[model samples]
Target chain A: MIKDIMLISELGELALIEKIRGYFSIGDSGVLIAIGDDAAVFSADKKNIVTTSDLMSEGVHFDYTYTTFYQVGFRLVISNVSDIYAMGAVPSYLFLNMALTGKRSEEEFDDFLKGVREACEHYNAKVLGGDLSLSIKGDFYSATLIGFADRVKTRSGAKPGHNIFITGNTGDSAAGLAYLKYVKKRIPMEKNMEYTSREIDGTILDTVRRHLIPCACNPETFIDKIKAMIDISDGLLLDLYRICAESRAGALIYRDNIPVSDGVRAIASMLEMDYMDFVLSGGEDYELIITSDSDHLDDCILIGKIIKDGFFFVDSDGIREKFVPKGYTHF
Target chain B: MIKDIMLISELGELALIEKIRGYFSIGDSGVLIAIGDDAAVFSADKKNIVTTSDLMSEGVHFDYTYTTFYQVGFRLVISNVSDIYAMGAVPSYLFLNMALTGKRSEEEFDDFLKGVREACEHYNAKVLGGDLSLSIKGDFYSATLIGFADRVKTRSGAKPGHNIFITGNTGDSAAGLAYLKYVKKRIPMEKNMEYTSREIDGTILDTVRRHLIPCACNPETFIDKIKAMIDISDGLLLDLYRICAESRAGALIYRDNIPVSDGVRAIASMLEMDYMDFVLSGGEDYELIITSDSDHLDDCILIGKIIKDGFFFVDSDGIREKFVPKGYTHF
Candidate 1:
C-alpha cells in the first residue's frame, strides 16, 4: 500500500506553533502582552492565583486505539480545569504544550487545537502562549491552568464530621472505556462536534461516548462551602482516600448511596463484570469529590461522612467492611 | 549480564512524585497556598507577571549518548529561566513535569532532580509542584516558570536608532554541541555540582561543557537601560530578525564586533570549519540580545545597531551586505 501522508517533520516546529497560534486569536484572549517575545508578559489584578499543570502522554495516559486527538485535547483541558476548580478558583488562562511524533499529520494537529479551543470556550478560559515540540515517539499533551480566587481551599481542611459529597455519577467514563476497548474504533456520538453532549442509550452510545470523550465537570456552584476538595481522576475510592490522608481523617461510604450511571451497569452486565469495580476503582471520572459540613448543600450528592481514622464501606444490605484503594497508577 | 536497576515504572507515578517532592522543601515557598489540593495556590503582589514554559524531549531535544540526566535537568531549568529573564522578570517559582519510560532507572531520575535543584537554587527560584506521568517511549521534561516584575521589557520596543547589545559571547554553546556530538560521551564539567562554571580549555573542556550544560545569562544588570530584549535561543541573525520584524525595524551588524568565544574559534579552526557559521546561526547560546538608546552600557558587548529597514551585515573589512536568517527549528 502506498501512503502519501504529510508528516510534521516536513513542516518544521515554528510552522506547527504558528498553526496552533492561529487557532486562538491571542489579542482578544489577553495573552498578547509581549506577543513576539521569549516569554509571555501580562498583568494580574487578583489577590491570589491558583496554578496547576498535567501531562498526558500517548499510550500511557491515552491510546489512539479508541480515541482521537480532538478528544484527547479536550480531556486534557478539563483535567487541568478540574484541578483549579477543586481549589475553589475560577479557571481563567490555559497554556498548552504538545510533543508529537514527527510522523503525525497536520490534520491531527488541527483537530487537537480545535478540541482545545472548544473546551476553552466552554469554560470561558483564554488560551495563552505555549510550546510545540517534537517527540521521538507517541504524542504528549500538557496543559497548565492559571485561575484566580479570593479564598483557596485545600484537601487538608476536612474535619472528622464533614459530609463526603460527589458532584456527579462515578464510573461512567470508565464504563465507556470498557466498551471502546472492545469495539476498538471511533464510535461517533454526534455527527457534529458541539460543547454539549448528546443524550444516548446506556447499552452502547453513552458508555462509549463517555469513555472516549468524557467531559470534566465544574464545581463552581458549591465551591465556597467545600472544606476539602479533589477531582476524581484516579477513581472515586482512591481520590477520596487521598483527601482523607491529607486531611488526617478517614471516610465511610455507603455503596447504595454512590451515584452511578446506567451506562456502567449496562457495560458491566454485558461484559460479565462487577459494576462496583468500575464504580470504586476505574479512573478518569473527573468529578469533584468534596467534604462539607452543610447538610442542605445544592448540586452535590451525599454518599458518606468523614471518619476519625478508618476507611470503611457499606453495602446495600447494611454490611460494613474495611476496603483498600486500588486505582490506575502510572510510572 | 543481569541488570538490577530499579525502574520508575516499578516505583509508580505517585511514588515518583513523592520522591521529587522530597527534593524540595516546599512549605517555605509561596506555592504551598493549598498544599495537597488539585492545584497550587499562592499570592503575587507584583503588578506584572511573566510566565514561560518549554518542553525538552529525548532524542529530539537531547540525546543520552552525549549528556547525563544531571546536565539535561540543569539545562532544562536554565532554558526556561532564560526566557523569563529575557522578559526582565525575576524568576520566582518553577514547576517541573516529567514523563518517563518504564525502563528509566531511579538513579537517572535522582540525578536529573539534583540538576534541577542546583539550577533552581542558582536562580533563586523555588520548586513548587508538577505532574509525573508515564511515556511509552523516551523521557520528556517540561518546566513552567512564574516570575514577577514591576515593569516589563519586550522585543517590540526597539526602534531604528537603538544600539544592539549581547550579554556575553555567542556561539559558545553551539560550538560545544558540535564537540559533544563528535565525542559522543558524557564529559565531566565539574567534580561537585556547584552553581559556578569551572574554567576550562577552548579546544575540549569549555566547549564540551558549554554544549553538555550551559548557563543562561540574567540581563538584570543592564535591563533597565534596554528598550527591547530577547534571548538568543536561535542563531544571532534569526533572533535579530525577529526583533526587527516585531519592532518594525532592521539591524546592521559588524563581523568583528559580534563576540565569538575562544572555544568556538578553536573548535572551528581545529575541525577546518567556518567559525562564522556558528557565530551567525548557532542555536542555544542562551545569551540575552537587547537594544538600548544609551551610548554606553556596562556588562554588555555592543554588537550591532538597529537599522532603518533591512538586515545588513558589515564584514571585518568594512564591506556591507544584506543577510538571511537561519536558526534551529524543531517539528
Candidate 2:
C-alpha cells in the first residue's frame, strides 16, 4: 500500500460522502443532526449569527504547482474563519463544497479532508456537512462558516480621532508568494532562505508558512474594546479604506509605525521589488485591523488615526502623501 | 442599450460584487448585516437552524448546450431551498459562491443574478454574503442555505407500519431531460410534445418547465403528521432506500401505486425507453416523500408502505421483486 493511488473515479459519490462523514463525525452537543442527513441541524442561541462564505479556485487562487492539497483545504478554512473572527464571533459550524478535477488519488483526497478536519478541530469547530462534485478542469473549494457573536463589530463605528490599529506584521505572505514564484517550489526557511545579508527574526520560511498555512488571529481578548474591526485580508491600505468608506471617515497612516518583517524586506530587495508594495498592499495576512477611541488596546499596535475626510500617510522622513489601495484585485 | 454587452472582464471584482449586493439588498429585518461587509450578520433566534450546501458544476453537472443562465441560477437556489424545506424549515438566508469563465455579457450575468434573486424572494430568503472568483475552466456555482425550524423532521423517524407518502408526479423531470437531449436543443412542446398518440394532461412543456425551473413541493400541510421526511433529489427507489437505511426498516413500494404521467409514458415509448426507468430511477424530481401513520393525509399521494425487514415492490400483476436503487450517480 506504499504506492496507493485511490482515484476518485474508482469510487461512487455515496462512498466519497460516506468517507467524508467518517472523517468529520460530529462531537458537538449543539449539533442535533450532522453529516449523512439532508441538512445539518444545530441549536441556535439568541445571539448575532455571523455567516461568511469564501471561494478559492485552483490556477486562479492557489497554484497546484507548488501547493499541497492539504494546504489548500486548510487555507480555505483559515480564510473563512478569519472573516467570522473579525465579526467578533466564535466560529462554530462549517459547510464545504468542493469540485475536483484531474486524476487525484484517494489518499490525496483524504489529505485534503484531513487538512480541513485538522483546521476545524484546531478552531474547536465542527464540520457539519459538505457537497462534492467533479470538475472539468482545476479544483475549486468553497466554505460557509457560521458563528455566534454577542456583539458584532462591523467595519463601521470609526470616527475622527479614533486610532486605527492592526495586529501582527504584514508583507510576510506577499513576500513568501514572491519567493515561491521565484524559486518555483517550496523552500526551507532555516538555511539561508533569506536572500539579504541582513538578519531578521522572521525568515522566508516563516513568510512562506504564513502564506500557505497561516493561522487566523482570534480577537477574543480585545474584541470588546474595538469600535470597528476587519481582517487584513486584502492588504492594510485596502482594508483600512474599507473601514473608512463604511464609517464615512478617512485614515492617516504613520509610515514609521507601519510594521514589515525584515525577512520580507530582504526578499523584496533581493527580488528587485518595493518592500512597501508587500507591506502596505500585500494581502492574505489574516491579521485583525481594529479601530478604537483610545490607543490603549492590548496586543494590538497603533498604526494610524481616523481623519476628517481624506486618506494620507506620513513617512519616516516626515513627508505626507495621498495613499491609495493597490492590492491584488481579481477581475 | 440594445447592443449592450457588459463583460465581467471589463468590470472589476469589486464592481461585480457591488452589483450583486445591490440586486440582493437586505429587506429582512432579522438580518443585522447583509452584503458589503466581511460577512453577513443575522440575529439568531431560539430555534433549530437547518443548514445545507449544494454544488452545481458546469460541464459535469450541467451542459450549456441548451440551458439558460437564468435557469441555472434559478435551479441552484431551488435545489438548496428544497433541502431546507425537507427539514420542515422556512428557508431564511442564502450564501452563494460563483466562479465565472469565458465571455459573459452584463445582461447575461444580470439575468443569472436576477434568477437567483427571484427564486430567493419567492421563498422569502435573503442572499447574504458571496465570494466571486475567476475560473480557468467552466463556470461553477455553490449555494449554502440556512433556515430555522421549530421542529425538524429527519428521515430517521419512520416506523414499520407508517404509510409512505410523496408529493407530485415522478418521471416528469427525467422524461423532459430525455426530450431535451433527443431534440438537441430546447423545444416548444405545445404541439405534439407528447411523443405518442396516447393523450395525457401533462405536455412536454410542463415536464420541461418542471425539469428546467422546478418548484419543490412544500410539505407544510402534512409535515406535522409525517413521522419522517426526505426530498427526492435522487430517484424514488434510491431515496426510499435512504429512508429505510436510516430508519432501520424496509419498504414496500406499490408499483401500481407509483404514479407516472401518461405524457412520460408516451414519450418513453416513442424514445424506445421504459416508462418505469424514468418513473422509478429518475433524479431531480424535487418531490417530498414522507412516512406517516394516517392514510387520510391531504395533498399527499400514498406510494408505498414501510415493511419490517426486506425491501420489495408489488407490481400490477401482484408479483413482488426486490427493489434496488439505480439513479444518476456522480463519482
Candidate 3:
C-alpha cells in the first residue's frame, strides 16, 4: 500500500518562524536598524525617534491556559514599553493591532482595553490608534511603540573602559517563570497570585515585579554625559557585549558585585542552577545599562554603577583578573 | 483516553496573524481594517495626523515563498507608503522594527538595505529609527508610518446627494489571484506558461494586479475641497457606507457608471457573479472614494460626489432609495 505524508500543524510557531526567516535578505542598509534588539532603529533626526513592535500569539506568547485577561493585557503593554525604555527614551504613544477568535465577551475586551489604558497612564504615554481584525483561530496581539529622544543608546555603544550601570536588578522574570511552572505542576489549586504576589527570597519575586512593571526614565532627566545606552533585555552579558561589538570594545567586571535578588538566588539554588548565570545571561531584564564619561562618574554613581571595566576582584587581598561576557542569543 | 490540543506554530503564519487580530479591541471606531486592507483607519481629526502600522512577521509576512529578497525589502517600504496614501496623507517618514531569526549573511543584508534605499527614493520619504529584536520563534518585521495632512478621507464621508467616483478601474488584483491559482494548478505540464501570462478578456486578473501593486495619488494634491476620502480597500459599496456614516451623509452611485476592467468582467461573468457587484463589493481596489464641495465638481470628477443626507443612490428615472451597507468586515 502506498501512503502520502502530510505536513502537520505541530511544527510549532518558532519552527514556522525559522522557515519564514529564510526569505529575507538583510541589505547593508537593509536595517539601518536590524532585528533582535529592544526596538528596531532607523535614522530620523530633528528629534531622534525610537520604534519597537511585538506580536503576542494567543497560545504561544501567552496562554489563556495560565495567563489571566488582565495579566495578558499588562504583559502586552509592558513588553513594548520596555523597548522604548531600553533605548533610553520616554515612551510617548503606542499603536495596537489585534485579532480575535470565537465569541469574546464584552467584558474580556473591556479588560483588555483597561490594561492598555492603565499601562499608558502609568508610563505617561497614550494609546494613539491601531488596527483590529477577526481571526478563525485564537486571539493574537501586536503593538508598536514610538518614543522620542535627542540621542539614542544602542547596544554597541559601550567603550573599552566605561563602567556598565543597570537601573535595577535582573533575572526576576526567569525566576517568575520557574515559579509559574512549579505552580502549574501542582494544579487544581489555582490562585491569582500575579497582582499581589507574596514576597519570596532568593527567587526574584521582586525582580519579577520589576519585569512586570519596569520603570521608564525620561531621557531628559540626564540629557548629557550618557555616552552610550542600551536596555537590558537579552541579559546583561549579551546586551553589553552587543554594545561592545557596536562600539568595538571589551569589558571587565566583578561577579561578586553583580546584583541578585534573594528569591532568584533561592530559586536558582532549588533548581540547582548557577545564580550568577541567571544574573549574567537571563533575558527580559528590561533595565537600562549605560556607559558614561569618567568625568561623569557622578552620573554613574547617581545611576548605580557598581563594576568598572578594568576591575580586579579582591578576596582576602588575593586580587584576580576576570572578564564577564554572558548575553542571550536566539539561535 | 487523553486528547492533545493544538499549538500555534503548527498553524502557520496566516493562522497566527488571524489569531493576533482576534485579540484587538477596535472599539466603536467605524471601519474594521484587517487582513486585506492596505491600512486601517479610526475616527480622528481630518486635519490632524493619520497613523497606520504594517507588521511584517519574519516568516509569515515575508516568506522565502515565491518572492525576492529585495522585493521583500522594497515591498515592506512600499506597503506603508500605500497606507499613508490610502488615508489621504502625504507620507513623510517611517518607524520600523524587525526581529531576526538568525545571523544574516552580510551580502544578503546589504541587498535588503539596497531595496529599502531604492524604495525611500521612490516614495520621497525618510526612514525614521526603529527597534530590532531576535525572535524566539522567527524573524519579525513591523513598521509604523506617520503622515501629515489637511483632511483625512474616510470611508464614511459620502452623503446622499454625492456622486460616487473611483480613481481607477477595479478587479486587477482579483484577476491576478485567479491567474496565479490557475497557473499553479497547471504546473509541471504547462510550466512554460508561468513565465509569460497574457491579459485575459475578463478575469479577476486585473483586480489581482491592482491588489498586488496599487497606484496612489498624492492626497495633498486635493487637500482643500476634499471633504471626505477613503482608499478603496474593501469594495466600493461597503467603503462608501463608511464615508456616509462618518459625514452623516449618503451616496448615489450610478451602478453602470462604476469602473470595471474587461478582464474582471470576463472572469466575473463566468463565475456567474454580477460585474457591478464585483465593482461594488469586490475589494482590494486602491482607488480613492471621495466627497467634495459640489462647487468643485470639476476637481472631484476624478472619482465620486457629495450628496445630501439619506438619498444615497438614484436611478435614471430620478427615483432614490437606501442602499444596504456592504463593504468588508473582519469579525
Candidate 4:
C-alpha cells in the first residue's frame, strides 16, 4: 500500500490553515485572541502602533531558480519586520496572506511555515491571523506587521547639516545576486539548480545568506540619537533621495566613504563590474540609512551630510558631481 | 493633436502611488504619520487593537465581466471592515497592497481609488500606507485593517442554550449573482459583456448592489449583548458550523426562520433554482451572525439555538434532521 501525498488543494482552506497554525503557539502575553478569531486581538500597551505591509509575488519579486521555499518565507518576515524597526518599533504581531498555486506538496508548506515560525521567534513576535486563497497564476505572499513604539520616527524629521549614517555594509546583496548568476553560468552541474547553502564555498555562502536573510537594526537602542531614517530597500542613493525629498532637503555624499564589504568588492572585480554601482544602485540591502546631528554612533558609519539645496557626490579626487538617482522600480 | 493615454506601466510604482495618494486625506486624529513613510503610525487609544487582512485576485476571486473596478475596490474594503466589525471593533486605519498588471488606464486606476476613498469616508477610516508592484498575472489586491475595540469578540465564546441571530438578509448576494448570469445568457448584445447597474431591472439591480457594495454591522454599538459573532462570508450553514466547532458546541437551526429577501426569492424563481440552496450554501453575504441569550436585538432576527451535542435542523413540519455543513472553500 502506498501513502498518498497531500496537496494544499486536498486539505482545503480551513484545514490547511489549521495545519499551518499548528506550528505557531500563542505564548505572547499581549495576544488576547489569535488564529481562529475573525480578527486577532492584542493589547496595545505602547503610546503608538506602527503598522507596515508588503507583498511578494512569484515571477515578479522572486524566482524559484535562486530561492528556496524556506528562504521565501523567511525573507517575507524580514521585509515586514525591517519596516517596523525603521519606524523605531519592536514588532509584536504578524498577519500573513498567501495565495498558493497547488503545485507545492504538504512538506513544502510545512517547511515554509517552519521558517516563518523561526523568524517570529527570533523577533519575539507572534503569528496572529491571516487569510489563504488559491491562485490561478502562481504563489503570492503578503505580510502585515504591527508593532509598538514610544517615540515614532518619520521620514520628514531630518534637517539640513545633519550627518547621514548607514548601519552595516551596503551592496553585499547585489554582489550576492551577481555571484549567483556567475556561478550558474560557470558551473554546469545539475546540483547548482537548487543553490543550497552547502553546495557553495564559505565566502560565497556568507554573501548569499546576507542576500537571503538580512538583519534589521533594533531602533529601541538608537531611537533618541537618530533624527530620520529609512530602510535601504531600493539602494542607498534612491532611499537617500526619498529622505531628502520628504524632509525638504538635499544631500552631499562622499563616494569613498560608502561602505562596501571585501566579499562584495572581490565578487564585483571577478565579474568585471564596477563595485560602486552595486553600492549606489543595487537594492535589497535592508540596512537603515539614518540622519542625525552626531556622527559617531554604535554600528553606524557616516557617509554623507544633509544639505539645504542640491544633491551631489564628492569623488575620491575631491571633485563634486551631480548625483543621478537610479534604483529598482516595480514598473 | 492626439493625447496619449496614461498606463500604470508608464508612471512606475512611486508615481502611481502618488496619484492614488492624492485621492485620500489624513483626517483621522489617530493617524500620526501616513503614506510616504516606511510604516504608518496611529494612536491606539482602546485597550486592544483588532487586525484583519484579506486578499482578492482578479480571476480567482472576481472577474471584470460582471463587476466594475469601483465595485472591486469597494468590496475589498467591505470584506476587511466586516471582519473587524465581527470582532466588535471600529476600523480606523487601512493599508492596501495592489499588484497592477500595467494594462489598466490611469482613469480606471483613479476610479478604483475613488471607490476606496468613498468607502473609507463612509466608514470613517483612513488610508495610511501601502505598496504597489507590477503583476505578471492579472491583478491582486490585499487589505490590512487595524482598528480598536473595548471588548474583543471571538467564535469560542458561544455557550449552549444561546440564541443564534443574524443581521441583514441572507442569500441576496448569491441570488444577485444568479440573476447577473441569467441576464448575460439572455441578452445577445455585446454590451452584455459588461454588466452595469443600469442594464438590469430594479429588482435585480437591488440584489446586485447588495452583492457589490455590502454593509457591515457596527458591533461596537451592541458588543455587550453578543456572546459570539462571526461574519457570514462562507454562507449561513458553513459559518454556523465554524462557530459550533470553535465553541465546542452544536446548533439547531429552524429551516423556516432563516432570513431570505423577497428579491432573492424572485430571482430564484426566475432562474428556476432552489432559494434554500442559495441561503444555505452560497457565500459572500458579509452579514454578522450573533449568538446571545436574549433574542430581542435591534437589527437581528433570531434563527437558531445553540445545542450541547449534535448539529441538526428543524423543518416547518417539526421534524428534526441531521445538518450537513456546506459552503464555499477556496481549495
Q: How far out, in Å, is residue A261 in model 2?
A: 0.7
Place model 1 in a CAPRI quality band: incorrect
Better-scoring candidate (lDDT), 2 or 4: 2
Residue A284's lDDT in candidate 3: 69
Select the stronger candidate by TM-score from 1 and 2: 1
Order of the predicted models by TM-score, top scorer first? 1, 2, 4, 3
> Per-residue lDDT for A1-331 in model 4, tens only?
9755543333433343343244234343344434331123344654566778889988777666776666777778888888888877788767777777746555456556656666777787666656767677878889888877766676777899899998888888888878866665222122113444556666666676677666666756677998988887778898888788778999999988887888788888888999888888888888898999986878788898999978899888889999777776675
> Which residue pairs in candidate 4 collide?
none
lDDT of 2 at A83: 85
lDDT of 2: 0.73
Candidate 4 docking band: incorrect
Cα error, residue A140 of model 2, in Å, equals 1.2
Looking at model 2, the pairs that clash are: A6-A106, B6-B106
Runs in model 1 deviating more than 4 A are A1-46, A188-203, B1-46, B190-203
Query: Per-residue lDDT tens digits of candidate 3, residues B1-331?
Result: 9655443334433444444454443444343332223344332323344567765544333444333455456656666776678667777556555554445544444455555556666676655545444433444455677665454555554545554555667555444444444544321111112332354432343344444334455556555556566766556776666677667765666555565687777766666656666666765555667676554433333444556654345565666666785755553
Of the two candidates 2 and 3, the one with more favorable DockQ, higher being better, is 2
CAPRI band for model 2: incorrect
Q: Tell me the RMSD of model 4 versus the true structure.
A: 13.8
- lDDT digits (tens) for residues B169-221 of candidate 4: 88888888777666553221111134454656767766766776767677665
DockQ for candidate 4: 0.14
In candidate 2, what are the lDDT values of residues B79-180, reduced to their tens digit?
A: 888888887888877777877763554445655776777787778776665676667777889999888777777777889999998897888888878877
